[model samples]
Target chain A: MLDAFSRAVVSADASTAPIGDLSALKAFVASGNRRLDAVNAIASNASCMVSDAIAGMICENQGLIQAGGNCYPNRRMAACLRDGEIVLRYVSYALLAGDASVLDDRCLNGLKETYAALGVPATSTVRAVQIMKAQAAAHIQDDPSEARAGARLRKMGSPVVNDRCASLVAEASSYFDRVISALG
Target chain B: MKSVVTTVIAAADAAGRFPSTSDLESVQGSLQRAAARMEAAEKLSGNLDNVAKEAYDACIAKYPYLNNAGEANSSETFKTKCMRDVKHYLRLISYSLVVGGTGPLDEWGIAGQREVYRALNLPTGPYVAALSFARNRGCAPRDMSAQALTEYNALVDYVINSLS
Candidate 1:
């Protein structure tokens, strides 16, 4: 029930990070908090974002929405969307925590096994996660309203290559890569 | 197998819990040393066959009695087994190095060692000697960085310590 900020703080309490690294983590967290609006944006739009993405995937894989497919029934379709949301939520936790282990252990560790057992098509699920990842990264790093602006222009106005925000963004994207690989 | 440290972190993560400061440090350290570890792993892995042959020759020279009748070193199977074990340990070390973590070498690396040896009617001493020689000779690569060498030694020594 804790808000993402509270959750991030709570996760930060138990750490063996060295003095300097702890400071770095603290700074990163502070900077991340400034960017909390992205998480907020994603949270606010998650359902529609997930549904639209999955609908596209389902549309392309026409057989899937037909009889006896992995997501044949409307109920299965709903489950797929729900699972996508769950994955997104956990990915957000890892983004805030600056660690991939959370996503790895909770969401992805046995997912392939579970999917196999339940007959979920991994390819569709992977595509869905990829869709979410792209959307989330866009929100985190860019303003959709300013679609014409180059992402580089935004960076040019700020820190250099070691830009903390850029680094965190890369880290966040890596989580998506991790998830995609796990599902793939 | 996963590193013990990563496994523990995974447990904490599953509980939706935060990390202890040490855990953060550990994970970050792995990230920092990742490149060097992978470098060392590449060097060792690239020379796997050569290292095995060199280590085997050295072991035989040091303990000629192992080549006697009824001894493990005398049989082609046991000799092959020695090569196989070397490859296994080296491969595991390479994984740990590339991953920048000292995985549970004891659990996945050295575990079942005795059973394998017994099954092959192998002597522990010669096998140990050959492994030590492999580590010693294989690690002598001049191109490896100090950090890479340190990381390499840490993993191989960890396996040796567990066994010896």
Candidate 2:
């Protein structure tokens, strides 16, 4: 599953703007003009959950936040969390666009930089993504409306969009792995 | 060759206290060139020798911290230790490229290098050998030669550059 996503991500064009480019990403998301209130809310909630989890990690393991002695002080931690939020927003937008290409090299590089700054390992990020997927699944299970809405959004595009979303989520892990590997 | 040696020396000097990414890049570039030259020398002369060791020795000499004087125990020089690690990483880059074909160097930290080597489908022997070589002074009489250090310089450059 991850291998396929890795191939897609690596093969994707590298020209797209970074996920940190909030203004541009906002404009892109807004241009779709499609009311994905439920879907958007789910993504937002998942992102918030991950952010909170990271905060918990920070509080519990302050000493561990040192990448080769480059500690993530409070200010740096805050900035990293902010970047993580932006990454989630970008992920949501990419999911909506049904194009994994939306998460380009710039976006991945931004993610790598943020992770490095936070001194967070790839395994931790993978766990966070898992939490996100679990939360999203639970949310959909509890509210059939969100599932319906997601399906409607998928119907607007080819089934490939759905595949893209799955691939995007899978790619998230692989991307972090690559970043961590490169950091070494 | 002399120009690259000068560039590396200058970069090391400029990176007095802290070596940023750019500083490391410059140093790595020179090391790669030196490694390439050493590899070429080995291939042409058909003699197994520490061709790149001269460049490595020069780099160590310029950076006093890299001198193996039991200073690895001092916490005050962690940054210096890191610089030494980077040098080892450069050498590992050359070794992996020429002999291992695809393993990460020790500069990525031991865990990082281990993970990468595991992922690369390489036997544990080469990774262990490289780690041992990086830490110790004498060369092992293994199938691989110090010349591999010179051979893989270009490969390291490609790998590092492609990361970003």
Candidate 3:
């Protein structure tokens, strides 16, 4: 051990790293930002994303429109829908920032209490977030022949941003997991 | 049940490296906010009796049946338990304020509380309302930064959510 330590103390190769190549690092960062931009593509139609998701949730749970349910009262329905939009807005923020704290701190920090105080339904809210997650992932999946997100990324000159698209979708999906678990 | 230490360790465990500079900065931010929280807690720590009294008074005013002496679950017993809980919540909030997180409340106090209240046939509304009273009646001392106040409100809301 003493011999090895003496050898290491005398070694320049072990202490010094070659610093000529940076393309790999640059490519990594560029790809990461590209994936982020791909995720942000879903941002333009955020209202549609949230509304469609909530529409699906309300469809599955029709009781939400009936008396005594959370969405039954006109004001209650507005609040429910507004909250869906708020959640999606925050989810988008998290996705774009590549961090969950923005969503956790701003929108979800006291959301449970606010929901309980307003008698908002947790189960329905959970489902709405899930639906949004699915829809957002769909928007990230690249399509070669249309009916998918292929045309969206075609401007970047890649017919197959396949793995990149898949990873971006995966990251986007996980942010909603935080929301679901927060409500859970 | 997240505190600065647990949160940093978890992040490091997730990424398999030292917690990054951003993580350290986030901790610093929480600690900065915590100074305000500590001051707020100190203000409330000395005034527990007055805070608890006003909370009970406000709750009784809102729900008069709580004033009854004859009803078993509806009046005296419920009032006593409710007031006790409200007092504990104020103290718990004080503790949480100093800790700068809800870790204490979730781990030590509120876990599984929803079911406990349900099993006891306790009305959650009264408890929730009493908590609101305790905080709004100035148990959450007025001289707090907006950031500190938001953190305090979040903990109170967390307790209310657990009950409801």
Q: Assess candidate 1 and give its TM-score to the true structure.
A: 0.55
Model 2 C-alpha lDDT per residue in residues A1-184, reported as the tens digit of each score:
1111122222321321111112332232232222132234345365455576565555555654775322256676675566555445444433333333334443564655666675666555554454455444433233324554575332223222333344333434443343335334
Give the TM-score comparing model 3 with the true structure, all chains together. Answer: 0.43
Q: Candidate 3 — which pairs collide?
A: A143-A150
Candidate maximizing TM-score: 1
Whole-model lDDT values for every prediction: 0.63, 0.39, 0.62
Predicted complex 3: CAPRI docking category:
incorrect
Worst 10 residues of 2 chain B by lDDT: B1-10
B93-148: candidate 3 lDDT, tens digit per residue: 66666555676567556887778767866666776777787656443335465655
Candidate 1: count the clashes.
11
Q: What TM-scores do the predictions have?
A: 0.55, 0.29, 0.43
Task: After superposing candidate 2 on the true structure, give the runs of residues whose Cα lies further than 4 Å from its correct spot.
Answer: A1-38, A43-47, A59-62, A65-72, A110-120, A143-184, B1-164
Candidate 3 chain A lDDT trough over 10 residues, lowest sum: A1-10
Segments in model 3 whose C-alpha atoms lie over 4 Å from true places: A1-184, B69-79, B139-147
- Models, CA RMSD each: 12.3, 20.8, 21.9
Q: What is the interface RMSD of each candidate, in Å?
A: 13.8, 21.1, 20.2
